[model samples]
Target: MKLRDELNNREGYQEIIEFYTSSINEYEQEIELLLEYEKKGIQKYSNPNLEIIKSTKEELRNAYYKILKSMYSKGDTIEGILAIYLKLISYFTETWKKSNGYVQMLEMLSIGIMLKIGDKDFKLLIEAVKKDDPQDLLIDTLISYRDENWKQLSGKLMWNKPYKALQEVIFLAKEDKNLSLERLHKYLKKEWFRGAVEIQTHKSKFNIHSGYWSFESGALVKILELDDATLKDQQYYPYDMVHYKE
Candidate 1:
């Protein structure tokens, strides 16, 4: 098969990564604007509506999808696409979870920012992302309706799978005295929320959950790493990681 054909045949993280890293150049301006807007406080785009933001996201998503389609069809390198996709996903995740005076907006933004899944979740979300499942149906309906109660809806929508995953780990830490509520809020602000915001455990199952928004992908649709090293190598360590005990 030709190179483009090969790329076309690929899917999930591999394909997404390929499109993102390779397409970063096209999105450089968008990245800069997003950054500037965040720094300036969206003063120019003042009444930030959920629909408008979702529309913008959809437009960009389609653009990337189209580019991937065209490129892969033409036999091109899928390299470099992943990085760009990761960055844009991060931006969207961060922007979506901010508090702009709306309650439901705040909740949906929070859960979506902290969305996760185990191995099964990774596969399911990845397929949905690829357009096979009705995830579009759920997230689209939520964004279209844009209600305050949608956060609960999100929990039901993801079937409380990833939510429980996060809640389980964090609750364990909280009860164990490894984290705080404010720190938990920090995790909610993330694009790829983890539990290591202020602490890390010694277990291999899950050592740390991050409270920062990842300028990378969300959706635990797949398990990436299964080791304490992820926490050990964290660039920023919270006090609970090694300083305290219950």
Candidate 2:
């Protein structure tokens, strides 16, 4: 069960890891709920707390569809609507910095859709993300909207699950703050989270700051910086290149 012992064997490494990491209570509870539903028995979007998240996902999908509708209001065209979705995905990714959870969810959603809906829709999104500027639209109205939402989500409760291997941000997301940051940070530092972290940056920097939405002040928000500097730190990313803005 020691880390070295497990990784030493190549035959059943994955199976061993899954067995040790999986929890009993959570797994059983989720499985029971699925059986009760008498459905496909897939355990997703089933977390009790995720009900609101599911609703939020619906809202975003509706927003994307509406954008498509407006663009094609004059006359419905398949290509035009596809163009709108491609732009929407880029805009969505450019803004909406909430819990790192959003990024994982969006990637999963994009992948799932591409598999189900076919490669045609997938191509549009791929084009948008690959090409920085929209060849189709001169103006990006979503730019402002993405910024506004980013500001709002910044203030909400968030998680700080970083990648130890990559040393980059991973599952940064929000859930009700049942535990204090200190408690959560301690929990993360424990050996269990080391594996949870895929990688850390060359900077070897890791920290979490607690901030909230400041509607009235409209100023910079500050919070406790809970990270330590390490010699192994990676390079810092410039704002313009990362922010998806000119």
Candidate 3:
């Protein structure tokens, strides 16, 4: 659909615009407050116990989560919520550059996790990450351990795994100019992937290896110019370290 047609066809279009406008304004205002706090020498992790920092982070998190949940509960379509998510990501990217890299890394990863519950969300995130932190390299290197094996996250590739996988791909790309999807998957198998399956029942519909995982894995494949067949094949293994030979 044309942009105008999409806007015109969406129900409560004006309301959606108003919500985004208001939310953006509020988010900007909050960022300003955080900046002012920083100016006052209020470091996010100044305290020995980091109580103040933790509290502030929790508050920031709850507020964002509340808004996201509220939007989802109101039957806002994925596109609508995605609009807000991108805006938030934009703001967070700026905030990330200003704050300590590690703190913002964790924050962005958490937000990424929440937003990556669906295929659309994960797809959106890949675009945003490229724009905000190209190649997912910044956060990846900052939080990722270079020597860690992929199998460590075999069955538990949660919040940071996708980025880690992408980072691994970067290394793989350099090491093997002839890198292929099968080769990449072989590399992945050597590290952290234990595999399992979850039926798409309503209660477990959003579990890992669901739509988002496949979408994310696909994104990584595309970014790395690798085939996606191996990733698709790995989704069904109910055991760890599949076809291993030691």
State which candidate has the highest lDDT: 3
40-99: candidate 3 lDDT, tens digit per residue: 867544452234433444444434433443444333554565556654553344334322
Candidate 1, 1-246: lDDT as tens digits:
243222123333244445654554555555556657767767435545443445555445544544433443333443433332333343343333213212222222223323321233223323333332233223433232323333322322332322333444333443542343333333444412353222332132431211122211121111121122224323222212121121
List candidate 3 stretches off by more than 4 Å: 1-58, 61-81, 94-168, 174-180, 183-219, 233-246
Model 1 stretches astray by more than 4 angstroms = 1-42, 46-54, 78-246
Model 3 has an lDDT value of: 0.40
Q: In candidate 3, which residue pairs get closer than 3 Å at backbone N, Cα or C atoms, i.e. clash? A: 150-191, 150-192, 151-191, 151-192, 151-193, 152-192, 154-192, 154-193, 154-194, 155-194
Candidate 2 residue-wise lDDT, 1-246, digit = tens: 221112123323333223322432343454456555545544455464345333444445434533442333222343544554564454344333333333332332332232232344444443343344321110121121222322222222122332221111111212222222333333333522343335442123322111111110000000112122220111121111111111
- What are the candidates' C-alpha RMSDs? 17.4, 18.9, 13.2
Question: Global lDDT for candidate 1?
Answer: 0.33
Q: How far is candidate 3 from the true structure (C-alpha RMSD, Å)?
A: 13.2
What do the candidate models score in CA lDDT, each in turn? 0.33, 0.30, 0.40
